[model samples]
Target: MNLIDTVRIALRALLKNKMRAALTILGVVIGIAAVTTIVSIGQGASRLVQGEFQTLGTNMILVLPGNTKRGGVRQGGAPTLTSVDADLIGQQCPEVLASSAVVWTQGQVIYGNENWNPKEMLGVGPDFLTVRNWQLEAGGFFCSSDIESNAKVCVIGHTLIPKLFQTTNPIGQLIRINNVPFRVIGILEKKGANMVGDDQDNVVLMPHTTVRKRINGSPLDNVHAIMVSARSTGKMNVATKQINSLMLERHEISPGDEPDFTVQDTTEIAEALGMITGTLTLMLSAIAGISLLVGGVGIMNIMLVSVTERTREIGIRMAIGARGKDILRQFLIESVVLSCIGGVIGLVLGTGASVGATVLINMYKPGTQWPIVVSIPAAIVAIAFAAAVGVFFGYYPARRASRLDPIDALRYE
Candidate 1:
């Protein structure tokens, strides 16, 4: 028989047992839907993380104090990094564009009767805003004079506005940190949240000198970390290496010995996060793929049953001069058609599910920007895999049906 005639006959046979065919397709649908949804969501999450990093500027590098070793025991991070190190890094590293020493403290911010606790209060150098690539909503950032003279001026993130100033203008207003009054010099533009959902706007920035001397009571040179910005994206690695070498030389650590500081660039951090997300996506995709195997098994089982049930019909066709190859083709086509239908339905459902999931997540976290990313290649592959599953599992049953003895099948009840 021609392929079209054979397909028509096979479809007619399935139509006679519509409920059975529908149930058989259910397994495939569930499997494909799960895989598609997982892949799409994974892609979206990866993109979101990369985008967050991009916002922070990929050319940025962070230098933090490393662990201290005493009596063969390792201690937590030591306060070895200082403002001098930050200054030297900017001056010595040719690839570095700017560097800022950062000192961190936590205190209640008060303005008149209103009092609020910020997530972080930082002492940063004059180049802090430049290194961070942050913009001002109003006023201006602290300059060299502010840091040099330890001026009591500060910049506040957007989130602190409602807590301290309400609807009143924040510029030039006095806000107290640990009862130490600081004149508001700038209002930072809103940064929303980081990739890990930390509120980026709930911060206060001051000169590193002011934070150390006035609030934390640390030495003039003391700093918690150093932030560096490379001259260009391609210079990040060179800048990181230069900083690391310069730090070791300054800290009096010998080459190949454990240094008391760590230099890490944003590119490395972004890659690490991307790797983590990619691994998770792969693991989840593998778990979801198990459903496809189960569905394949279901197809095999149902096809075997179909072969048995259609034995009489098969025998009549064989007796009427139908060939075994034609019978096999007909049965195989039926199975593929069934799986293809399920695959198409599942693709649609999975795409919708991914979008709905993103919307729900964004709704839950109002400022979040979870995205829906449906990969066309993934959809096409899912459908093709379903068709392949049909062929692989349907082969044995089709063979059995094709090989039925005409005399024996014709006499069967």
Candidate 2:
């Protein structure tokens, strides 16, 4: 028979056993759907991490206190970052555009008869908002005059304003932090949560001098972290190296000893996190793909039974002068048809599920570009894998049917 004739006959036979064929195809569909959905989630997560880091700040460097390792052991607790290091880096690093030292105090805010139980009160220099690329929707950010004068002025983030002031205009309102009064000078633009779920919008910024002297009761020169902005993306490496050397000198670290600080660039952190998430996605997709192998084995078993049940028919075909290879080709076509049907269904279902999830995430967080892209490579892989399963599992049964004895097959019940 011609290839088309063989395929027509095979399809007719399969159509007669509709339920069995459908059941066999179900395995391939399930396996493909699972793998595709998992990979989609992985891709979404990678985008989220990158967005979160970028929102934190661009081309920025975070200098935190303490050496990364202590006594050959990695440090566990948050170490103290002093204002001296922040000053030195600002003065000595030619590639650095701006820098700030941050001191924070957790406290309650009260205005009139209203009181906020707890709020994140940040003590930062005037350049903090600028380095962070924060924009104000209502009033101006803190100025050098505010920092130098130890002004008791505050800037509140979007979420914090709603919580403390409700529908009232928070600008020019007086909110007391730890019973200390400060005028609200600015309202920061909304910055939504990051991938790890940090509330970037719930914060209050005050002058570093004010936070040090009035709230935390710490010295004016003390700081917990230093944020530095490089002159440009290309200048980050030169800036980081200069800052490290300057810190080592100021801290009096020996040539063989590690410096008493750690410097991290935001872009570098972003790339590293991307690689980690990509690897994780690949692993998860691989695990889900194992189900495809199981489905292939199931196909093999079903085809084997199909061959046995059709032994008499095979014998008749052989007796009618059909060659062994013709019988083999017919059976192989049946298996391939089954797999192809499953693959088509799976592709549709997987793409639908991925798009649905992307929609939900975007709705919850605006400006989040979680696109549900159909991966051509993944679709090709799925289809090719399904075809491969058909061949691997159908070969034995096809060979068995082809090898049947003509006279015995025709006489069999």
Candidate 3:
């Protein structure tokens, strides 16, 4: 028989037992669907994380308080960083473009009849806006004069507008932080959220001097952290080393001794998070792949059973002068057609599932930008792999049927 005839015969045989064929195909469908859904979701989550990091400035770096040890006892978060250190870093570190001393507190902010509690009330230097690469929606940032004179001026984030100001313009208006009145000089542009889902816009920024002397009553020299920006992306490592060396010398610490502060850059943090997400994606994909293996085994079992049930038919075909290789080809084609059908169905279901998952995530998070990304290459590969599975599993069964003795097979039936 010709190739066309063999395929037609194979299809007709499978159609004779539609229920059995469907049960076998369902196994492959489940396998392909699982793999596709997992890979698509994993890739989407990775993209979301990367986007969040990019939303924050890429060249930013943070100088935070490290652990301190005194008389063999370790203490968490020593108050060692200061405004002077921030200034020195800006002036001395060639790779550092700007630096800001930051102090923070949390309290109720009152404007007229409205009162709101923001996520952060920050005391930052004049260069804070430069270091963070933040922009003002209206008015302008505080200048050096404000820091020197300890001016009672502050900037508000976009989220605070609806909570406190209503329709009134926030700029040039008076708001009280912990009951201490300050004029709002600037309004920050909106930033939705960070990687960890913290609302970035629920904040208030004032000069470090004002926050130290007026609001919190902390020492003017002490600061909670120092924020800095590297001159360029390539200069981040050099800037970190320069800051570390300057801090060690300024603090009078030895070369091998542990310092009282730590330096961290956004580049390193982004890479670390990417690594974690990538590893998780790969691990989950592998777990999903197990289903594909199970499906292949199921195909083999069904094909072997088919060979036994069709033994008499195989004898009649051989008696009618059908070649062994022809018989094998027909069986192999039947198995491939079965798997390809399942693969197509699975691809459609998987794509739908990915989109549904994205919708569900957005519903829970509200403003999150979770995406549905179906890979075309992955879909094509899945279908091809399904075909390969059919060939591998059906070969033994087809060979057994092809090798049967014609006269003995016909007599047995």
Q: Write the per-residue lDDT of candidate 3 for residues 1-413, one digit (tens) a residue.
A: 99999989999999999998899888789888887888788788878877776666648889998888899788887798989999999999999999999998888999999999999899998888888778889998898899999999999999999999999998899998888989999999898876466889999999999898888787548899999899999999999999999999998888777889999988887778878877887787778777777877888889888888888888999988999999999889988988888888888898889889989987787667687799898899989988988898878888887888888778764
TM-score winner: 1
Query: How many Å off is the CA of 398 in candidate 2?
Result: 3.3
- State the lDDT of candidate 2 residue by residue for 60-166, as single tens digits: 99998874675678775445567667767787899988889988788988877777654467888777876787788899778878877889999988876667787
List runs of model 2 lying over 4 Å from the truth. Answer: 1-7, 67-84, 87-97, 196-198, 230-239, 265-283, 309-329, 348-376, 399-413
The residue-by-residue lDDT of candidate 1 on 307-363, one tens digit each, is 888889999999899999999999999889888988998899989999999999888
Candidate 2, after superposition: displacement of residue 276 in Å? 5.0
| TM-score of decoy 2 | 0.80
List the global CA lDDT of all models: 0.89, 0.82, 0.87
Q: Per-prediction RMSD in angstroms? A: 2.9, 4.4, 3.0
Sort the predicted structures by TM-score, highest score first: 1, 3, 2
Superposed Cα RMSD, model 3: 3.0
Candidate 3 C-alpha error for residue 389, in Å: 2.3
Q: Pick the winner on lDDT between candidates 1 and 3.
A: 1
